[model samples]
Target chain A: MDIDMSLVDWSRAQFALTAMYHWIFVPLTLGMTFMIAIMETIYVRTGKEEWKRITKFWGKLFGINFAIGVATGIILEFEFGTNWSNYSWFVGDIFGAPLAIEGIMAFFMESTFIAIMFFGWNKVSKKFHLTSTWLVAIGANLSALWILVANAWMQSPVGTVFNPDMARNEMVNFWEVLFSPVAINKFLHTISNGYVVSAIFIIGVSAWFLLKKRNIVFAKKSILVAATFGLVTSIFLALTGDGSAYEVAQKQPMKLAAMEGLYDGKTEAGLVVVGALTPGKEAGDDKDAYIFKIEVPKMLSWLGYRSGDAFVPGVNDLVYGNEEQGLISAEEKIERGKVAVQTLTEYKTAKDEGDMETLAQLSPLFDRETSEGQEFYENYFRYFGYGYLNAPGDIIPNVPMVFYSFHIMVGLGFFFILFFFLVLWFTVKNKIDSKKWLLRLSLLTMPLAFIASQAGWIVAEVGRQPWVIQDLMPTVAAVTRLDASAVQLTFVLFAIIFTTLLVAEISIMVKAIKTGPKENEGGK
Target chain B: MNRRNIFARVLFFYVDGFRNLSGWGKKLWIIILLKGIVIFVLMKLLFFPNVLNQNYDTDAERSNHVLETLTKSK
Candidate 1:
């Protein structure tokens, strides 16, 4: 059966579209819920009616973001079963566990507490209401935890052994899958990024209020909390980002190479602080990868290996093989992967035919308990996705996209730390209202937070392209063989529906912000 | 909070919340409702279905279908 490359492209586009849209709402929910919880805690402690009003106001915005997040989130999961059923079947045993756990967390925890947090205002005790708000925050972050665990498994598949008879990877140790270093780093990095985005969101909205000379007290207090949270989380974000880079260097060298636009292997490689990619740069070419570059010396090596002298492979090294570094070329992996694919089919055929002799011989090759099986699994079966590719170049992801997105995300991250510090300093000095330039910049920074968040995800996903589950399955092999037009149609429909929802959300949010917390009404 | 009583409180909590929404809340609720209908109702029911589960009843059958689909030359 010939592959419909168009179908593969459309499925990728649709999934990316849904994921990107879902993300816009999720960070706000993650960040704003905690901030709202903090505000409500102050109300409970101080017995202040004004703090309660502020909590209610921010909670209202959080609720608006949360609703759309739930809708888009469901669609993203279903896209797996619908469009990428091949990936669903291959790793479903391992992948579905996290998502199912996430569902339980979202339903039993987040939904239940969020209702009480939002609506049980006057009906519940102050402490109980505050506890409910905190639970909602924890529940939402836990949901992120499970999903990132699942995503991390795709980036660096572990704790699963492939069973030829079932034609799927089965989870062996649940703890190993859960606590994989990649999962921990990814979960922490992602949540902190959300916190930073949320802090920016709060500061921006408050800055707008300050600019208009409306709710001066409200805006200043919000900025104080947001800036403090932002500064702390921005530091956490950088630390986890370094941890993520280390994990990527170890488990996904191709992604690391793409991220840096590195073409030649090096010891003590410089981390590109700012650079432009040379036009039409390709791996193994004579052309230099960067047009002009400025880099922090030895940072890349130190980031990846904790040693400034450590060797770091690049695109050319990954593609063309480096025997000195024990790196097998993509071409060699494809050859071994072809044999593994063929042998799996033969083994299945033998088992079905009741060929006991052949089965006896082949069984050990799939069994990790056996030495032969361990070797075969490690060397060949590990490269199974490579068999699906037509050329060595197919192994490389969209390098320029990953490069630019990664740079943008990292550059903005450093800027945010300074931005938050300055915002807090100016506000603390009682000069926030007077600083019109800073106030306008704060308002403008909100969209940049959204961009940085989106760029971070783009770097993670696009940097690991071709493989849906790194070295286990390429996206071309993973996509369900639906007609191209069907996917195109659904993609358009989702585009329209999501756009409509986005518009409605913004309209409702702008109106809610314009209205501000009901000055006349309190604790209904 | 016993289980049934807690459940009842949540049920009424949501009901009362919906009942008491002011203009902005109601507008947001409308978007939520319309979007819920479009996504969970229309999209899930009409557009997207679990292909393997819908087509095959047993695990063995589903596995066989997926294996054939994946290992086949593209």
Candidate 2:
């Protein structure tokens, strides 16, 4: 029954590595598929050969990116069973449904129409091919939606009941899980981030073409579409980001505390406008961890609760109880969780012995029909993850990592807004292709977009800390009992293979772009 | 004919397909197959350890241990 800490760490590291690599291509695929569709739609409407050429060119790049994304994504799906077999078993009852549904509904939709969009140019009717292109875009996004819903459920588990006998969480209300506020906000936020990344990518590459003046007209038109799209999605990304913060504040206050590096309870805690934290600072003991910090007065409260004066419990307050915030200590939750765990065990033994009295008493704690039963269930069942914890401090996530990642992501988000605005303005002035410095800046934003996307994931995932499913299971308890060396070997293998695929993908994309769109035989 | 002949025919085609490849293509295919085997079989057989299932032997025993730990109040 001993949990190997090293195995858990290595497994987590492996998943993170694969996920980050998978993410590099996914956002672009999500963004560019729709861009190509838009171009084709224009071609369909205007009957312009130029629009068709543009669509075909971008579609080529999209196909290359899509292939590697599919390859890495397949690996990720299997790793769930291979590395995290325990977590797969524990929550598979509820978790497996969305993934399976995604494969049936979204993946099928994408993979089927993708061929038509790529190779059916002269074979199919223009209208039908256009429809297929749009379908590919819709399918890719729908796939993202389902995957995010699954991840969001892990963050805020809903519509599920704990089945002690089966030793797993089972879905009770699929609708609740699908439509939970967290899932919806996560979908909106994540997809908008994708759109913004794609827009930046287009603008950057178009800037390169403009600098060389190879495809000036095509580059300008592409920049116009991407910049406008980027600007709108950037604004939406910021708004949904606020909604995400509010959800975290409500469902995972400790994560919020880690993200902001808030260590002391306050009624109106100021938001860290810009901050630098001291290295190796511990919460509860190190009060002044911020080496340099700027604050916006009462902004955190207003953002989190829609009120400027609402009490927000800090990290220390959650680890050690805060009376004002009505927060109980993690230690207290551990004790309650232990009771719940013990009660279930005894109940199992009684059932084995055919003791009806003990069964009746224990049944109320698991039942949710009556008011008393619901209260008991809420009080003890909610803290189930705490039972596995040895100390209250184990609940605290790596604050410095979450804090820096959040700031970096937000900073880059604002920068993108400004960058897109300038690009759009210059295009209107007829100077977009003429400005060499601005083109270089636009080109630089391509990598920055990826960095921001990765940072966003780090903030969301690492901020959740020990819990894989918040309050239900700690990651240490959820990893498969595999040897650390096995995980390390697989991790290295995945790293090498994925890196090779990434290099190949980039080289092919560069070559495609260098070749440019094929000339139309009959038209300019 | 028989199952063995059918298998041999399939294997022959697979090997011939590789043999027909250019030098670089052949090398690339070999590298890919070697990596696949190392990842799928050799690594798993030599390194991957499954102690959780081994230790408890049964679900009932594991559940019992977890319950005992939880109920043991300080």
Per-model TM against the reference: 0.97, 0.89
Q: Which predicted model would earn the best DockQ? A: 1
What number of clashing residue pairs does each candidate have, in the order they appear?
0, 0
Backbone clash pairs for candidate 2 read: none
* Candidate 1 residue pairs in backbone clash: none
Candidate 2, chain B, TM-score (2 decimals): 0.43
Candidate 1: stretches off by over 4 Å: A522-524, B1-11
lDDT of 2 by residue, A1-524 (tens): 25778898999999899899999989998999888889888889999888887787788678777765664565566676667656666685577898888878765675458756754666568999899999998888998888899999999999988766556678999999999999999999999999999999989988988998888888888888899999999999999999999999999998888888888868888899799987777767855868999999998998788888988888899999986668899999999877776777777778778999998888777767767668867888788778778899989999999999999999999999999999999998999987899999998899999999999999999999799999988887777656798788888977887798788778867877787766772142
Residue A445 in candidate 2, Cα distance off native in Å: 0.7
Task: Point out the worst 10-residue segment of candidate 2 chain A by lDDT.
Answer: A515-524
Cα error of candidate 1 at position A45, Å:
1.4
Return the lDDT, model 2, position A106: 62
State, as a TM-score between 0 and 1, how close model 2 is to the true structure. Answer: 0.89
Report lDDT (CA) for all predictions.
0.89, 0.81
lDDT of 1 by residue, A1-524 (tens): 25989999999999999999889999999899899999988888888787888888899889888866666899987898899888899996687899889888888875678778877878888888899999999999998999999999999999999888888999998999999999999999999999999999999999999988998988898898899999999999999999999999999999999999999989999999999999898888899999999999999999999999999999999999999999989999999888888888788778778999999999899898899999998888888888888889998999999999999999999999999999999989989899999899998899999999999999999999988999989999898989899999999998998887788778878878988878744456
